[model samples]
Target: MSLSFERTQSVGIIGGGPGGYEAALAAAQLGAEVTLVERAGVGGSAVITDVVPSKSLIATADSAVAISEASDLGVQLFATSDVGRPLAPQIAINLAAVNRRLLSLAGQQSDDLRGQLVDAGVRIISGHGRLDGERAIVASTGPGGTDFDRIEADTIVVAVGASPRELPTARPDGERILTWTQLYDMKALPDHLIVVGSGVTGAEFASAYMNLGAQVTLISSRERVLPGEDRDAAAVIEKVFTRGGMTVLSTSRADSVVRDGDGVLVTLSDGRTVSGSHCLLAVGSIPNTKDLGLEDAGVQLTDSGHIQVNRVARTSVPNIYAAGDCTTFVPLASVASMQGRTAVFHALGDTVIPLEQRRIAANIFTAPEIATVGHSEQDLEDGTVRGFVHKLPLSANARAKMMGVRDGFVKIIASEGSGTVIGGVIVAPKASELIYPIAIAVERRLTVDQLSRVFAVFPSLTASITDVARAMHIVGSDDES
Candidate 1:
């Protein structure tokens, strides 16, 4: 079925996240009347709570780490006061101010996105929106809950996003026991923070808090942190985390967390207990699909409650679509935006390119960030595909040496015969910035030899990427010779 653009069609979007906002903009550009319904601020959790706030906090922690190492660069920081002998230079964190700035930045970003959507001629509605039917949405607005707006549209896009999953045994009280979002309200840094779960969220928060001068204990149910990430990258991060005085408990699971007077106690399934001033729950996320009248509207959802969607973001109902965390398993904001745009294009009868999950790039915002794109070593081992691996340590890079970075490496995977770069992983400081070229290489099907031919800046972290590609090229040459 194709959309008839003979007349102006209305597009109703439920959620104002990357997915919803992007879809709204795309639909507007396609000459469709768009109305975006968002219960929170525009830009969703990416701008308001989850991605932007967390990354901003990590940025502050990164600054603190840089300052602590300033003396190593011959920039001495000394105590100025003297009376009863000599004083020592110390790093002090004003967590209140830091959190305030984080929230302020997030708020500003949300406002900017809202302004952009407004300029694009998309109507913004502040309320909880649900599917009234296949082609209509009902928005519940205001404190009284009596006023409601019924919006009818030719196409409906759901991008309500997801929320932090709460364990049945332990629920967040927003105080000593908290989810990641509640951390910004803290007046002071946690004295001893216990982070539950070892996924990307947990690792990032654990690393950030440790750098922020908090004693951290990371509890992982798996053999290592980031069980889903590249093994070498996870190992390097674990090593850095341990070397930085953070305790890592592997192969241990937290059964529950309870308030213990002034602190919190996390009990493991093995009957062991861990006490900390605060506990951050980063177990995972649950799709925000409940009470949305989705099933009633004939929308199919996965067993895990995610909206089942096609590559073009079509739901079971032809006129209805889903994107972002609401439908995608890989919940990166960039992917969400792409999926949203794809949905809008398909709905408006425009040519569309479906999102390729394998080509999606994701980053863990730890001190030495871990970023990856395309295939992984695990996939190769599982015989999912054929590839050759080449690794280059960051220590071997001139830029890493100048920055005193000895941890992390860049790993690339290429096809056996063609030597096309299929995937790559980068673990280093600012790895997020360095992974883009590799992502482009993977997406564009650039062979290792072709990637090596691209000029990279001297004394730069990106040099490591080209170096790995060049090494792979030489290996391929040797095999041919």
Candidate 2:
């Protein structure tokens, strides 16, 4: 059954993250009366604290790296003294200014998104919102939770995002021991920063601070950094991190983080200790699903506290839906937005497709970014899937040579029998941008021959993608012969 676009329905969205706001906007577009309730800023953590702020910091670090490499490109960056020795160029970072700019950008983005929602006729409520019953949403205005406004909606979208998880032994004081959000508020850079956790967040922060001229020590509890990511990509990043003067401590776990006078000390699980000026705990995140009265509303939650939802974002309750970091195992802003839109569409009785995690492209925002889509090499090794794989090193590409990029490569995986592009991984500078084509191919189920035939710019990073596709095609053809 298809719902009419002109049909008027009410949607109450809790939280203003990518998932919540996007759902509100999508529902409004479908001619639904939308109400968005948020306790903090409109953009959620993705804008205010997590994704935007971190990327902004990474941009600054990237600029510093570019400037450092300018001399190698014959760009006269510094002047030589009379004795033929180059004068020392002073390079310094004003943490206060950098943080101020980051906050400003985040605020601007939030304000812009808020403006868009308002213009689209979605009502914005500033408070903590939750399910009062099965179909009613109650928003408490103050910290006391006294004053409240009740809204009756045909549908409810729970998009309250997650917060950084802290260990009992190493709580974030938001000062010397910090979470990802608190790092932006730092007034001064740490002289020696120890980042605990080797996931995407940890690796990115470690890379950024190292490029920003800090002595960084990265602790990985697993065998390697980004253990969940492509092994080749992780190896490249580890190599880069080590070469950049970062101490990559693999197979190490922080037992506790304690403040020691003017510095911090991180005690490993093995009883050994590493001292640093500051320690960042990027272990993981816990979904913000408690105190929402979800159980009372008949919404089921997973053991990990995430609201249990189907592909279309429907919770166990017929009218309640959940999206974003709170519900998704893959906590990405883009995925959150898609889930939100899907939920709104499904709730309104519109035709919609369930989200396919396999087609989702994820990128790690490090200096040399790692992007992957669809089937992973692990899937093949584990015999979970059968596919043909082809890899091309970026070092062999002309553009890479020009840019002095010798690290990273592109790997493509195609279905064995049909030769359809099933998955790919890219590790390089701007790998994020390069992964989209592979994602498109995977989503559309395009054949390797079709992907290989598409023209890419000569002497470009993207040429390597086409090269990989062509190589896969050739290998497939050889097997047929």
Candidate 3:
């Protein structure tokens, strides 16, 4: 059997991130004449700087920690300390090599995507794309340089991802006070890093640098780190980060950051100053919707400047769609990819399934990665649902002991009487991977009994799920939350 698609429709995607690129491929595969326009390199900020680089750095850092754990398994390992070495030579990760590899992988990915698009007859344009008017997009090489060319599209996918937002008082100079995007340009490691804003991005860097042998201080404006995450999961990560030698400044907001001679000083809102070799501002991200002529094109934007879109990625304007971080969606690469695919499906008059927030899973790559799916403890406070939460400690599991693990747990929430799994949290090594089973249960509306019946290896880390399901039964029997 074979599938056929109409090749007459033209689709123009305006970003090269996961959302934009994926949509381009999908649209092209569906037989649309696709044109992908990107100002920067393909992969956008997410792959070029934010997600890929950070995760790769974390991978190397985690390998270092894993090497240290060899002795725990009764195997001896030794390496001369790089400390006390002169800082004059500036020994650290080579940015040229790192960027070469990062760009290489990104390029390979982009090339593969481009090949797929081209094979399906999609055009690749290297430029910034914006609305000339409805049904038209004007492209130029850069901000000002323009051999202006206008392309008319039957359908348009807006995937202009996002950028690091700067504070009015403490704008980044891209040197001392740096945005997360600027970290990839460095060849030398900071002696001490003061990371303001203890959100997922901030906490990940704070933990990463600490592992990379830098004194890291995390400044959180909220009472706890990862204010947007599940409270118990955030608390576990906070404990892990603190125990790993990172100083956490809770309830402290950075008022300003300034270079003081050789080091940078971060002044807090409480009139205190913290000094560090460098400062990373991980406050949040702002959507790149400003220059796209969104207002002129009649695309509705939120107060924070994110484009408003429906589940299928449809914008207020018909025939126009938005996806990825630019839309008012909780930004995740997975969500971005799904949104991209969904937008293309909707644009082509295909059978489009509206996005279900409950089916999505998110992860925070801390020491012990935190993964969550469906309803969180924070959701309960808003009276959105009636459910009960059941938490299981990793310490109680035999596999954790064998792996020399501590300081993590799995929490599951289900409907009060129905016992249908609605949400879950995992804070352990490979928690990101382990959370999927629970997520599948949640998405499929499976019960605790069904989950408990699923076979998990004895003395294995994944057995923790079965234990958690069993615990839920007890919790249900006791009629306790």
Candidate 4:
């Protein structure tokens, strides 16, 4: 007997970003008829512009940093001078070539996603799509901009991604002032770049550009960069930024940005001015929920226009689900993909696991990246869980010392009563990859003792996780002492 109903279930998804793309695939895999309407290409802004291109650019920047530090690793770069004198080779980013490469990389990723979706039997429609009541989607197709494709389905998924929030006083010219999406269009790195907003996006770009051999000044309205992240991790980033010659303007809020002759001038709220060749507004994002007929169809949205979604990505209307940055959940791409699958699974009456914030892992893609999972120090400070924290500096790790790494630490939180791993933070190079086992421990509610029993490779960064777990286990047990 088949689990699918007598009539094949239909899933109609708007926006072909990670969320919508995954929804279409998941629904089709469940033997449902799937139609995906995307204004942009498949893989959405994340592939076409945001995550892919940005990370590729960061990779280029990382290469530059590696070359600069290669001498410390006994890899010398020398150049002969005209007078038979030795000269240190200068590292320069071929920014136009870098931009082209990243864009091509992004395009290839988008094409791959489209190909996979096609193979999965998902009907892909290229147009702007909106919900027609609760059960149908109307898309404007064709070059004339008036042709419409009316599609009806049993289930509707909204994954329309958000756009960078723009302030009225500081409009993006795409030349002097730019959004994260507009950064790729830059033919050459700016002589000086002023980054407003101290969040993950701003900090990542600031770090990347500074490492790529551009002067960067980061203006943070908050006391520290990457607010709402792990405090210690943010401190490390700020220290790194300062030590790397990036000017940090903490507690300074940008009021407006305007083109000043050949440069852009940023006026702070305190009447101070800072001029740079370009400016980046990484303030925040607004969900693309307007004029989509969401409210008219009774799908509830928050005051800020983010779709109100349940644990399983369900909306006010049972048949309608929402996912991605457009939804009022964690705005990570990984989270969006999970939400998409979860939404489809719930709709199809399949085995569904509701998303929990505690189990979700988040990473900031800065140099010495910050990755975290489960209950944080802030969460445990006054929360219901009786947990104590253990911190291990990466400097003490043999692998880190061998690699000449000295700037990050691994912090773990475990319940005092059960010694269960509740949370962890890793501040190191590629901490994003290092945080997975800890994420699993948090998801499985594994005790520190159990976590310690897991073998980690010697002379590896991951050994620090097990080391911290061992330390926590000893701290939680009096009998061992």
Q: Using lDDT as the measure, which candidate wins?
A: 4
Listed in order, each prediction's TM-score against the native is: 0.97, 0.96, 0.92, 0.97
Best by TM-score: 4
Give the residue spans of candidate 2 off by over 4 A.
1-7, 79-86, 474-481
CA RMSD of each candidate after superposition: 2.5, 2.4, 4.3, 2.0
- Model 1 lDDT at residue 209: 95
Put down candidate 2 lDDT per residue, 402-456, tens digits, no spaces: 9978689999998888888889999999889999999999999888888888999
**How are the candidates ranked when ordered by lDDT, highest leading?**
4, 1, 2, 3
Model 3: how far is 71 from its true place, Å? 2.1
Candidate 3, 82-167: lDDT as tens digits: 78443322224554565567656755765676676667666878888898666888888745756777889988889998888899
Winner on lDDT (1 vs 4): 4
What lDDT does candidate 1 reach at residue 295?
Answer: 99
Least accurate stretch of 10 residues (summed lDDT) in model 3? Answer: 84-93
RMSD of 3: 4.3
* Cα lDDT tens digits for candidate 4, 326-418: 999999999999999999999999999999999999998899889999999987876767789999999989999888786899999988788
Colliding residue pairs in candidate 1? none
The residue ranges of model 4 lying beyond 4 angstroms of the native Cα positions read 81-85, 474-481
Task: Write down the lDDT that model 4 would get.
Answer: 0.93
